[model samples]
Target: MAKRVLVKFSGEALAGEEGYGIDTQILNYIAGEIKSLIDAGIQVGVVVGGGNIVRGVTAAADGIITRTSGDYMGMLATVINGVAIQEALEHIGVETRLQTAIDMQEIGEAFIVRRARRHLEKGRVVVFAGGTGNPYFTTDTAATLRASEIGADMLIKATKVDGVYDKDPKKYPDAIKLDTISYDKALEDHIKVMDDTAIAQAKDNKLPIVVCNMFEKGNLLKIINGDTSLCSVVK
Candidate 1:
């Protein structure tokens, strides 16, 4: 089992059945899953995306908003999700610390690598908000960056899919699920397990990444416990 890990949750996952905004039941379910990890002595850090609320790249593509402004809005949306996650974790008696790259002091502390490491060491789950505090960056990159900074053993990307597939499983009925893949192969094949930037960063740091379905109960804990059958590992 990994002693420490960083889990990347997509903003859409937080939306649950509503397809927008946070869902109370979903939040509670996620909190329970996280609580299981905490109870098992795993130090966890979370990086949540803001695509459910606002996607800077998508907005910019529409030509209505500047990319810079849209990205900033997306970053703020991440903070909102972070706060909601913090509340959910705390409501379940899990101690958590919210840190934002953009420095929303009223809601969270400034992102400091050492401070975040300390928080994890103290058995507190640290939630990283804001997408690198900059435009033109995705939360996948942010998660990889935070994982490297905090020396997490591995980065776990929680997605709707069970694992990395050769093609879009939703669209392609014959899609093949990969049990394991190399970073080079992922990049070469153009697999959409994560953004290229994030994959490259993780590769450079020699950090392994596990892609799995978060909606499946106990899957996260299983992955941490060295179960790779249900997920795809990229190293």
Candidate 2:
């Protein structure tokens, strides 16, 4: 049976060859990959981050805007990304829906767990936008929360790196990638890959989390296909 997977793609992953903005080539690639998953009967949900465009915390440091206001701005950035992804997917003939935490009736439906589930069951790929509708929470936590609420089988975190490493692989010469690791170990060792809150949420829900490279072609498909040995799995 096809599993219900919540894919959390970071903004950096969408940077593609140019390293900024929505790269049409990469979006099409991702859309094609996701369409394959939908064709194979998988229920797909996406939670995209907005780091490529703006980060609330970074803007809050200038003292010009309050943290809450900055975070809200970041949330809006996610909505922009969501619309881009929705358009890309729809252009490829994939049925897609964008549900936001912030109510914007003109763009997409406000996020309701049950309604989102219904859409998934009906074979529509649902894109979850807007952070938790809260200021402090990161999109990582939003992904974890949504995955738990939607009863997804796993949270597939699409990162720039292929898998989770003991340290920042780019900075360290001997960073080791783990094929499988426990949530306890990730917390105790301070992996720094995701926020502690997000990890804790996933651990509490006992949802399998896989960290993989989104830029690599067919990686997402392999993940949904249950190739556990291919990526870093946090159990």
**Per-candidate TM-score against the hidden true structure:** 0.98, 0.95
Worst 10-residue lDDT window for candidate 1 reads 186-195
Off by over 4 Å in 2: none
lDDT of prediction 1: 0.94
Off by over 4 Å in 1: none
Candidate 2 differs from the real structure by a C-alpha RMSD in angstroms, to one decimal, of 1.4
The candidate scoring highest on TM-score is: 1
**Backbone-clash count (model 1):** 0
Error of 2 at 212 (Å): 0.5
Model 2 earns a TM-score of 0.95
In lDDT terms, how accurate is model 2?
A: 0.88
Model 2, 110-218: lDDT tens digits are 9999999999999999999998999999999999999999999999888778888888889998999899989999888867667888999999999888999877788
Clashing pairs in 1: none
